[model samples]
Target: MKIYILLVITSFTFGFLEKVVSNPSPRPYKAIFNLGDSLSDTGNFLASGAILFPVIGKPPYGQTFFKRATGRCSDGRLMIDFIAEAYELPYLPPYLALTKDKDIQRGVNFAVAGATALDAKFFIEAGLAKYLWTNNSLSIQLGWFKKLKPSLCTTKQDCDSYFKRSLFLVGEIGGNDYNYAAIAGNITQLQATVPPVVEAITAAINELIAEGARELLVPGNFPIGCSALYLTLFRSENKEDYDDSGCLKTFNGFAEYHNKELKLALETLRKKNPHARILYADYYGAAKRFFHAPGHHGFTNGALRACCGGGGPYNFNISARCGHTGSKACADPSTYANWDGIHLTEAAYRYIAKGLIYGPFSYPPLKISPNKIA
Candidate 1:
């Protein structure tokens, strides 16, 4: 594994608006069920044989972490980890790592590294040796609720009771589908791709709703075009399309479109299941702020390049992994918005998680009606 070092610098306004609001009548969630890709993968890669030790499991990766890798894909805890902590719940356990004792109490994480909204081949390449978790599909994760419940709970009634208290997160999943489309040079394919992806997500949510997921958080896709890997790979002649910060507007446009469609899909789902409490987590907005204004958030370089990238349009040479010879690692990954070409640093995830906890997306004023709590 060759590691390249780069210093990313960004100059834009930053810092999230802070406002104190009346806490709604103690509507706290008991547990968090996470689903998605590398962004949320706590330790599934190691547990599922997708990634070997010494890469993410080594000292540098977890040097700033809890003195051990603990299966997180970053230098420290991920966005979901922070969210779970904020809610005062134990870190969600990987669904694959569920033991007899662990299964009953804490929430389960079905998020796998390289998971996609669609049944694409990238997941297979990402290294899920056995499809034991499910039928190797997002749809199947829902089915596991039924299978795992009986064994996890004392009785069927107890299982049902637990289900109602859980908070379901279905996201960080669709980015792989978009990545596949981008790598294939068929951006137009998203027109067709977006629907099924959104459908699969909706279906997953519906299943959770049926199984008793009342408090749901569905995060939309991040700005794929703004990634350092993507910018280096897909550099455009029109600098106007790209800001001084080096984020591509065209690529971000696609992401915005996907999010719009996802919002609509979620709205429709809400209509179908009015009782299910659903909130859309806006990853794009949070990421954009981080990239545009690095300094305010403690990030210096906004668009120098990724700390972990190889050779490609965006310097992502698939042949070389991060931390390898000739591979690039950013000097102070905390200063750069991107940890790798595709992922955000633990700091970035932390900021995003904070936004989710108190931002407009999570606690919308109109959405929080006084009557609902009363």
Candidate 2:
């Protein structure tokens, strides 16, 4: 009887081991496709001359990165770079500058630094004023991708196959719309603004899906009102209602509402396209944590001040600019959460990327032994 029981146990154990070996969880994504704004711009802005000669592209701005300007909006790497590295993929190359020599098998960045979701009029005016990249809208970007592929692949079917195997990142674009609307005093026109922005994003996703993007990641907006630059110019009388961390509750609430609606829209898209795996990258939540716990990251003081700038109020000037001789420099940029008035430092972005990678946003509910690979 004992021998028979031992034989049965051995059989069960061997069967379990076989099953485990035969089916392992799908590994993390091998490549990343980044689409968005200055947050993930890489060197596109500088390479395109959007940053210009006397601006942030000079010394002090890139003092920490490559010991010279690399066109990144921050002191160092962007969030997308960290995400790509985390997934063991090479740094993403700009979609606009894809060369025949470069290996685009990993992924590409469609994120123009000053890109917007809405029409180009607003950004064009802004670009005219600042000499930045005239808005590369999502629609046009998709069209660019379509045109570039035929040259890379032998046939249309081969191009589609490459897209099918690749991941698509579609976001960090809409903020320019909000920034323009706010500057234009069109917040009350959200009825006119929000829907179109969402539609444009949806259209971009559908276009990518049609091209065979099975895995997609979309990021929502951050709290723009909480930034020191915005607050200095537009601080409400109800500042008392703001939390101890100086984040405006009402602004955060608006952000939450936007994210909630976006989540629902993504879910609907998933239902419509059953084969596509759509995930929302929670930029709002990740940013909030950094603002709340700046010290936990690396920022110690002046969380709202720009690292390279000249000014007293926001540590920024539309005229004095970053990397200038007279510009005020922060003692330590890694400790501060905010880089410019509107963006985050490399350290802050690193923390945010880490949160998105290991947090509920990337893989919700902490799936234990979930069968992702069939």
Candidate 3:
């Protein structure tokens, strides 16, 4: 029966995306600059040598789309990839992989998997030294961008023109800060990190604006309660703790609080930088639709469950994570909302991109100026 359902859902992927790209026309953004964590990471994490023989650089990680691993923490392309496709731009190259001057002319991605909004020093100061895995925080990513700027454009006027034509993606960040806090097993500490995290993101945005960014899309965190890892780690016998969609209410509330604060910060940023278009991408709302109606979205395998991982109710086992031995993948990845336990599948990302591109998901639905489209 499970196999039968999976096959049915696989067929639905083609139909589900028929109208997802209502406006297939391209946008005028000549280049894209992205900053985030695993959700948007194209390849920096793998190229960085952060972990030798990292599981993410193996088979099954990029099996769905690229036909091989590409350092993304999923089965195929991410939301950023779909966004680039919609804009009629090539997939952004990881900054670390740049070898020639022409590499970043189209776009550049500085996002790294497991990156936090706050620096490692902040976590260490907060007594989360044990949780610190990588030092490539948002601040570090900004520094990389700063170093690359001089090479891209020499004069202030040149930079202004170059950046104005580029689209900036600031986040879907700050989640790893919370993730590390969660690993520290301190719910109180986790909640406390919200304010500083938002501030850090705000600071990054301000710096980008100073550097000539005119258009930015800052995304909020997703509903962590609906994630398989959180569901497993925070599982409870208390029925009241779980929401109607089978997600933990407490974790979801945390994500909501973060989103609320982040949105408030973006509101302030818009007021401060009236000249720039600072749009807020409601990743939570875009993703929550799947949990509300999985079947409608062709996620017949359900929303919270992972398409690839070790055995369990959610098909997720931390000890035996996806890309590692003893783990398995679903026959049809397009049928599942999640790919591994942590990241989402290409199908789910397409839906979220659709929401942002043409609908009620973004603050002002992302649209291409008709004249801008060739």
Number of colliding residue pairs in each model: 24, 4, 0
Per-residue lDDT of candidate 2, residues 1-374 (tens digit): 99999999999999999999999755456456676777787766666667343355655555554577666777777878877776667888887666879887677777777677765764454443343344577776777677755554666687666665566778877776666556555566544566667878888898878876777888888876567656655667785757776776665666676677778888889899998788788888777766776776567764666776667566776566566567666777777777766677777787877776667555332112222211
Best by TM-score: 3
lDDT of 1 by residue, 1-374 (tens): 12222222111111111222333344366667777777887776667775433466554465455767666667777888887777667788887777767744667777776666766453355343233222235665555555766665666577567767777788867777777566656666666777888888988888878766777888888887787656766777886888655678888888898899989988988888888778889888887786777788787765345656675545555556565556766557777666667677777888887777766556331122222100
Instruction: Give each model's whole-structure lDDT.
Output: 0.68, 0.69, 0.88
TM-score of each: 0.80, 0.82, 0.90
Candidates by lDDT, descending order: 3, 2, 1
Residue 151 lDDT in candidate 3: 78
Q: What are the candidates' C-alpha RMSDs?
A: 14.1, 5.0, 11.7
Residues 56-83 of candidate 3 have per-residue lDDT tens digits of: 8998989988999999988999989988
Kindly report which residue stretches of model 1 are placed more than 4 angstroms away from their true locations once superposed. 1-27, 51-54, 121-135, 154-157, 310-317, 363-374
Model 3 RMSD, rounded to 1 decimal: 11.7
Better of 1 and 3 by TM-score: 3
